[model samples]
Target: MPDKQFAPGCGLVGTVKLLDIGVPTTNLGAVRCGEARAYAFWARNAVAPAAYQILGSELAKIESMGSYSCRNTVGTSGPVRLSGHATANAIDIGGFVLKDGRRITVLNDWASADPALRQFWDVIRRSACRRFGTVLTPDYNAAHRNHLHLEDDKAGFCR
Candidate 1:
């Protein structure tokens, strides 16, 4: 989809395409992101592979809060700045669904008692960090206690 210009210095910089991230999403249906970057390739090659490696079952769908928000960065106390979402270059992952109908949510599974569950989250986070420029998990702060913020901004900040 074409980028919509909201105002001066505030809008997507490139075509916003629906990413076929190799897995469907529960809420997002189609992962819409900037086409100027390799976010889709990273999701399909890096993120999906890592997830399938540990899931042991067929991965069904990803769960996302949404993307492409026209807003500033949250959880920061300094001067406000446009967020990756402003340009559709970021995605917020909230959870996952297995083919067997099992669901894993970051809010509940990130600190799950099951070792395997914890390991799954760890592996996914690490894998995303390898591709996305900025990966923020529940461990980053309270604001992210329910989702993993993945951005392709070349910031290289992961937590």
Candidate 2:
């Protein structure tokens, strides 16, 4: 079933309905198994806002790198360890596709993307760090060489 939550009094926003909140979570110590209010709120406020502003009023869909992976960080060859996602404390954003049939992939587009697209992407990436406890980008490491990793890490690391 989908888990719907409100994004609070963020600037122009509505309820975020995460369809297929899918999979029961056993790693985050019973945070209701899906996106917690804070994470949802952060994503909506941090990422969604920029989506509309940057995608230009013609936004189509937001592509997700993925969420809720029951594994360890990439290149960690081992028995699956807990990922930030396991705690519902992380979100992986890959890219965006506009209504004009344009495919903007994070890996390829971030550097050479049009000025507007690059601005939009950078805005959101920086915004995520400002809003979330931790934000990882392609520059962070090979594990996240393609997507933005937004997490509510109490350590206050923004790399």
Candidate 3:
């Protein structure tokens, strides 16, 4: 399992500890209830088709960079500004695992030569924008070059 923790803060007051989306997760990471709901929604509505069309397989799991990191928007070294992550309201998606035992990662596949892979990302990106309050992709900045940052704050900031 990937590293995970439950240190909560940023107006949350320790109310959230685990990101139980009501499904078994591989890395055992945590997420805010809203983020989990959005992820579940897009996984079923978008990831399934993207997986089938690109790899002719079913999506087995959605990979993430993690959630609930208490930090600033720029990262650990930056000034503290209470990112959505600080409240477990954000999730960083890095890849997807297919039932065929294939892993499609954003770091390598986001700009791959395969049209299917690119198309798959496009579909997911658009879908995320619909569900998340803030959808930051590589297009947003260098910080998001390797994953899609999904946050639900009802802020209506999607990119």
Candidate 4:
């Protein structure tokens, strides 16, 4: 299931779809065309290139919290602006599943004791900053303590 229409009143303005990028995921995560491309590009240019050096294996799946929802930003109460998720313009990557059968989650490994994991995490974050306009990590706030929020809003925010 690549593309689907959001239910009426989902706060989306156009067509949205889950990306099928030839990689396995724990579940389907919806994203816009640009986001999909960014993910693919990151996988190809960042993850794969450093997989062996960091994880001693090939890159596998990217575990994500998925995308597309009619909701406000996390930690916000009422009357908040719609987040990129509301329009399928963002992705929340929770972890990376390596081909060596190692699962590295952001919540668990962002500050791992192992030097390789820490380095890998930072590298991915910086790489994401280069590609996405808004890249929020756990350091940004407690609300983002469990995932790397990548959005292509071109707002020039990378924290």
Candidate 5:
């Protein structure tokens, strides 16, 4: 088991844990420190409004794809190198489900949803750009068609 954490900045406040923090690249996915901050921000800022707007309530929890990058997207056809997770700068967040039994998943219903949902997602995505150094969504490219990628790159660029 990894360290259990309760991050305050993350609206989650009391709900955070690490299954494993220092596992090897082969055993555990790469994760970064900056990415953790990005995730906390996403849960606190973006996920909250998106939930209240689309699901009719604030989200109870944030589903995450813990950060760390040992390598970039597969099939890029190049030599293997450091992934976003290695720097702990990028995180792949799946989505959030509200306390009211409503779900807001980036993969399942971000774009196909109704106007309120679309607006909610848009607002959150744009807001993330302000909090994170780089924010990428399904529209940024096919690479991010499945999840919301938030990062605090040293370069200070946003997607």
Candidate 6:
């Protein structure tokens, strides 16, 4: 467990608690996030198991676009709101690698012509919806065209 303090800017006003999931847990590699315990548990339990079931291979790594930033939500109109990343409570997953040397990326594989590839992304997205309160996929908007935004919030919004 690690804690980080950020200077006041970009909608961040105080010290932010963080957890680094950079160490390999199960077959997944580094993923830096704010909600470490919950995210790590979900990765090890829900994500890895689902990947094995769908891909018939052990998950090797989870490619992330990092986490914990002081920023506003993208592609939104109206008043700008602090992004979940502002407090280190969300992560953007861009892809995954499997032990069999297969790489699945949201940008390329989410709507892939291959049925198996499409199914894999669909299953993973649904699985993430079950655990993370907010799950935003490429389908959500063009701003999320290449990653799944999983946030530890109470929004109950998954798309």
Question: Highest lDDT among the candidates is held by which one?
Answer: 4
Off by over 4 Å in 3: 1-25, 75-80
- Candidate 2 C-alpha error for residue 108, in Å: 1.2
Runs off by more than 4 Å, candidate 6: 1-34
Q: lDDT per residue, candidate 6, 24-92, as tens digits?
A: 433222223435555777777766776788778988878878676778899899997888877667788
* Ten contiguous residues with the weakest lDDT in model 6: 23-32
**Measured by TM-score, how close is model 4 to the native structure?**
0.85
Measured against the true structure, the TM-scores of the candidates, in listed sequence, are 0.86, 0.65, 0.80, 0.85, 0.68, 0.80
Q: In model 5, which regions exceed 4 Å deviation?
A: 1-33, 73-81
lDDT of 4 by residue, 47-159 (tens): 77677687788878888797778777887667867788887888888988888899889899887899898889888889999999999999999999999999988888998
Best-to-worst ranking by lDDT: 4, 3, 1, 6, 5, 2
Go through the candidates in order and give each one's C-alpha lDDT: 0.73, 0.58, 0.74, 0.79, 0.59, 0.72
Alpha-carbon runs more than 4 Å astray in model 2? 1-17, 20-39, 42-49, 75-81
Clashes of each: 0, 0, 0, 0, 10, 0
Q: Identify the superior model by lDDT, candidate 1 or candidate 3.
A: 3
Tens-digit lDDT track of model 5 for 29-97: 334445555555566656676677665886666666666434554324577544444455567777666
TM-score pick, better of 2 and 5: 5
Clashes in predicted model 5: 10
Which 10 consecutive residues of model 3 have the lowest summed lDDT?
15-24
lDDT score, candidate 1, position 14: 55
Q: How far off is residue 16 in model 4, in Å?
A: 5.6
Once fitted onto the true fold, the runs of candidate 1 whose alpha carbons sit more than 4 angstroms away are 26-38
Candidate 3, residues 1-159, lDDT tens digits: the string is 233454544434333344444332354255666677777777777777778876799887878787767877864355567788787788888888888998888787888889778888888898888899889888877888888888888878776
Candidate 5 residue 1 Cα shift, in angstroms, is 14
